[model samples]
Target: MKIPITAFEKEPLKDHCGIVAAFSTDDYPFFETGLKGLRILQTRGYDGAGFCAITKFGKTKTYKGIGMVNEVFSDGKRKNFASFPAQQWVYQVRYGTQGIVNDANVQPVLLKHRDGDWFCVAHNGQFAKDRNKREEKLSDTVLFAQELARSREASWDERIVTLLQSKRGAWSLVIATKNGLYLARDPLGIRPLTYGHLIDKKSGELIFCVASETGALEQMGVTDFFEMLPGTIARYNDQGLHILHQDKPHQTALCVFENIYIQHGAGRAHLPRKGNRQINRSPTIDDVRRKSGKILAREAPIKKSDADIIIGVPGTGIEGGMSFARAVNIPYFQAITDIWDEPYEQRTFMSAKISDIYQKVLDHFHFDAASLKDRSVVLVDDSIVRGNITKGLVYLLKKFYNVHAVHLRILCPPIDKPCHLGVNTRSAKELIAARLSGNIEKISKALGANSLAFLSVSGLKEAMYTPKNKNGFCTGCMSGEQYPINEFGEPLAHRRKKATQIFLYDNVTNPAPILL
Candidate 1:
């Protein structure tokens, strides 16, 4: 079966990694279940895939490779994973936000502590550095594993909590042990992690699942679902699920980009408010995009004489564009289609390099030029990254079809800064809007759009507000808003840097006696 593209304009954004774990009362082949879950949520990570399971005898077995989930687990390997012989399984799809993409850096970073205990850690979030500059070589996950090994804490849960408290940035983590599974998220809950369970009607066997997206859990036949509490630790095993630790939550600033562009288009962010304290309650991704579309239409109405029809850049842009067209009494058409040569490789917007993404867009996009001839088209897209996709599409339309004029509408506010969380835009210079000094008109002219309009930051905030998350959403990329925690005042990394230290499997980098 072909994996479908769900992004706007085939504009690649380096995706955040995804994690899924299943603990079953029956021997349900959790490894296979985890793999299938990863496949359903493949857009979250395309660089690498890995799975680690703790056998009944307290041994951890891990298989990792650099490629898509299917490519990493071929027919022969799938058979091997099917018989992994474990009740608990943790699978991670990596996009390498903090480290280089290689076999060693692939996740479900299995660690063998000197105390003779084995634990595997998989996470979704970008780890930030300590302002004081501590250990430098490994990514946050691996560095955490190393520090966790060195902890003098007695229990694994305590050690994990300590490590989480010490680090900064977004993290929703699942650490697997022979005894049980432990789950935790950063204080702000910037990234998403949901807890769910599948109950077998006849036997009453319960299978607990934790995943980065709700859609993955639903595909596994899960119905009892909810977001994993932020700043809390939960444990699951044969007995039942238990909350081990519940820390006070920090100010809410969950990544708004997830709702705007990253999440499964069908998924919803269902986080209940704690106690009487008000929080921002987000609508479903579809609802957010649709509402934003309506707001964009009202805020930036197009002249009927200037445009013939509205066209959505397929996938993510379709819902919002349709909403815009409906609000404005204009016809909406899916004039542009994404064409992929490989059935399974459908992510046209996952690459970090603009050149790589531009080439992919050129290879994948098919426009019905004849239909667009002499038409002033209203082109709606999710967000503008490097502005390559919009520019290329406009050029194609005008050059091939003699299009009269093209007006661009974006569903989100202008992205004026690079993302430091899990997104791929690492440098401010790489962002087209920021490069243009946040000048919308210049950006429009550069992209070849006759006129350009973007949703205002306040409008986007209004669209995403809920009774739960009433304060606001993360608009760091759009407005240069400070991030939560220690990442609040730090500068954005304009270029990729290499780590000086390495963790896992003995190396001379810091050859000291392993302690835990």
Candidate 2:
């Protein structure tokens, strides 16, 4: 049977959803605190937002909408939603990497079990098993919650572990039940999950927080946070956090793209000190990007004479661009600025339609033509996926801004393979690098740049390596290397059938015309 494709499946690379949950010992409502954390993690996704809270009255309260975090929890709805007295909550900002973007796909998905127990789940990565036609209409997170709720396991923790261990793919999940909050990460560590604690000043009570990124925890005044180890499941309750189960160590395959593009630069990764897991030091994403930039300069050097000014793509590329300029001894200019007149901060990469993506580019980006006119330019970006945005920018520079030359430098290696783990790049055919057979010249010409260069896989590894992250990274998208674990998160030797093609659905009910 042919399955429908999703808008996300058409995009080159889309952002992953963000999940944040908090458990407070105090009686006060914790949904507000979870919302604040979700705001800080908004960059991870913006397709939709929602939260599920377990009220002090032993009731489940959920509110969701198809928009950003603030939009979902708008001013009019805030008073009523915040009035509830909740001690545990789970929140999600979605990008719908697996399902169509709509109200049905918005998370934290609240479901009731056969035993009449209600649970909510918010997930941050794609579930590999959900690619089949049977699950096409539902988002992976929703399907996961459904499976969990249907499980015959006597306890919530047992149900969570049983369901997660039996599946594959990248996931960092936060589940809320009347009993407490539960958190789990995939065995390969393909997605990021961090947990931290903050002290509630008034009640002198300790609050436990779990988030997809450290930035969210930091927003709640949490200075020290611990990265959840691979194949781990833990629970947060009135007694405090407890590790229920942890799978034996496997080759670590943390998603490398987090540091390169997805994560907020302000977020920090804790590194063990002197090989001691008990002692750790932290490095912000900004530091890693700058270091990567410095290394990229050495790997693909562009002298001052070759380019007059270096311009980093706004938002993610700024840090690396600045460091690249400093490393090359060239002047750096903020030539690209965002046009605030747009209704919302629309990310071009997040748009499903090519026309919509291009329109957003025209509406959102503004070039300082005065400073950039008639000058050689060094354009730095985090990565070049399908090359649409890069090509558009290059076209604007040469056609409108009249730049003399455009030299493009990318901090990430050429993504030749689709990321099956979490990111929405589903087919190699959609990647410019793979289509061009990894030819730098052909890729450069395709992007309308005079020259283009990408950081090597080894260079990326060197830049991202930290003591705590010594296990390794998942470069499957760049190198086409097989993961230590298959798409189902099981050992490769026991792998299931070949990877299945993901169907595209126009909406929850109808399948799109095209079939892969």
Candidate 3:
């Protein structure tokens, strides 16, 4: 029997990557544990997956492919890798925000030092600088690994610290070498990284694990964990985990988008409080999203008569939509359902071509035309990057679904600048908000919505941290402000000239420019 498939159009913002690493004192096999952790953090990336394993004898093996974790490390392949006993493991799921999305770019990138020692690194963020003419084809992570291998530093830990201190960008890296497992985060704290330990029940040996998110640690039954401070480099070896270097104190600029979209709902952040003594309070990403919705409702409330129901844009938007519906005293409905395509569910944002993105939207998302017929809908979504998907969904509701009206509510503030820290949106021209000068009315009209509103910058901060807390966030994309650091790994000043240089660089070098 043949089934007809309706075609629709949509797109989304893309995340960077996720990394996981494990080291055991007793030389226990950690291949399976690493795979499990990668699965838990797969939402951060899905374009490719790979892992590198180090045996007790210092022999290293690496496997990677351009697919999801399960597809790359299938049951048969897992068995093959498990046959080789390994004491240390590192895995990565990549979204390819930088360089080409091919086999060569896949991470857990293994490189040989000039001295003949081999090391593998899995990275979770993008570099701010462009590759030189010689290294144009290499991804940032691969180039980083090459540099580490060729460095003149006396030790691997010293090489990592020296290289990272000179580079600009948001990176959370897990490096595996014959000596030990090394983990590092960028000075700005623009990305997330956490490390934890679990005791083996039988051997009573300690196992150390590090990941871009805490959820992966939880999946491995690790309850006691600590978020790595910004600019810190640490290593886990036979002796134990030790801090190799900690960069001088700087203004922390954690990426706000992690709370808004990139991170999983279960992910949490430990916000530091200000008082006589510092105390950290944790808040789930889900809670922050829901609170953003509530704050949005207060800022721009839609009447019940105007909006009969609220529909979340699926996945990340669901939490915010539920809270928005409750705040407005309107009924919430799962009017949009995802049509899973077995093992190969396509992400529209990850598509390189606009045509492919639109096709994937039709293949993956199904709208309930019958339920939404002639009903006014308030569509809630995380953020509108290029506005292709938001515009397509709005047009479908009115033209095909026969919806009366669509009042679009975004959970975050209007993004008017490109993210230099790790997100895929690298050019400001591609951002609808940036194109429209952050004008609400114009953006709403462009999206074909009855009205549009975004949660304010202050509201977003309130939702993530306490009013009295001293936590800092990188709102450069929203406010067109200077990032904590510039592309040269120097502290950024509030100079318009520097901003202009960055904008010019992006326009000239960006390979994937969205055309409206």
lDDT for each candidate structure = 0.72, 0.74, 0.75
Per-model TM-score, in order, reads 0.87, 0.87, 0.87
**lDDT of candidate model 2 versus the reference:** 0.74
**Runs off by more than 4 Å, candidate 3:** 1-12, 130-135, 270-281, 343-362, 468-471, 495-516
Cα distance off (Å), candidate 1, residue 357: 7.6
In model 1, what is the error at residue 27, expressed in angstroms?
A: 3.9
Return the top candidate by lDDT: 3
Clashing pairs in 3: none
lDDT-best of 1 and 2: 2
Model 3: per-residue lDDT, tens digit, 1-516? Answer: 011111111123456788888888656777887788888777777678988888777788889998778888889899987756677888898877778789999988988887888888998887777445443577888888888888998888778878887888888888888779998887777888887888878778788888887788878768766777878888889898788987776667888888887776886753432220121247788988999899889887888878889998887788999999999999999998777666554543545455554555566679887899999898898888887777767776776788878888889878877665677765778788889887776777777788778887777888887655434777777754557776545567755522211111011122211233
- lDDT, candidate 1, residue 448? 68
lDDT of candidate 2 over 337-453, digit per residue (tens): 766552454443555455564455666678897999999888888887877777767777776778877888888888888776777786788788899887776677666677677
Task: Give the lowest summed-lDDT range of ten residues in model 1.
Answer: 500-509
> What tens-digit string does per-residue lDDT give for candidate 1 at 1-516?
244444433233666688899887645556766776788777777778989888666766789998888788888998876766676789988876766667777888998776878888898887775667754445667877777777888887677777777677778889887668888877666788887788767667678898888778877777656677667778888888878877775566678788777777767653334631121233568888898899888888876776788988876788899999998888887778877666455455546555464456657777776788888788888888877667767766776667877788889877767666776666777678789887765677677667778887667766777555655456677743444444443434433323311111111122222111
Question: In model 1, which regions exceed 4 Å deviation?
Answer: 1-12, 134-137, 201-204, 270-272, 275-282, 343-362, 485-516
Instruction: Arrange candidates, best lDDT first.
Output: 3, 2, 1
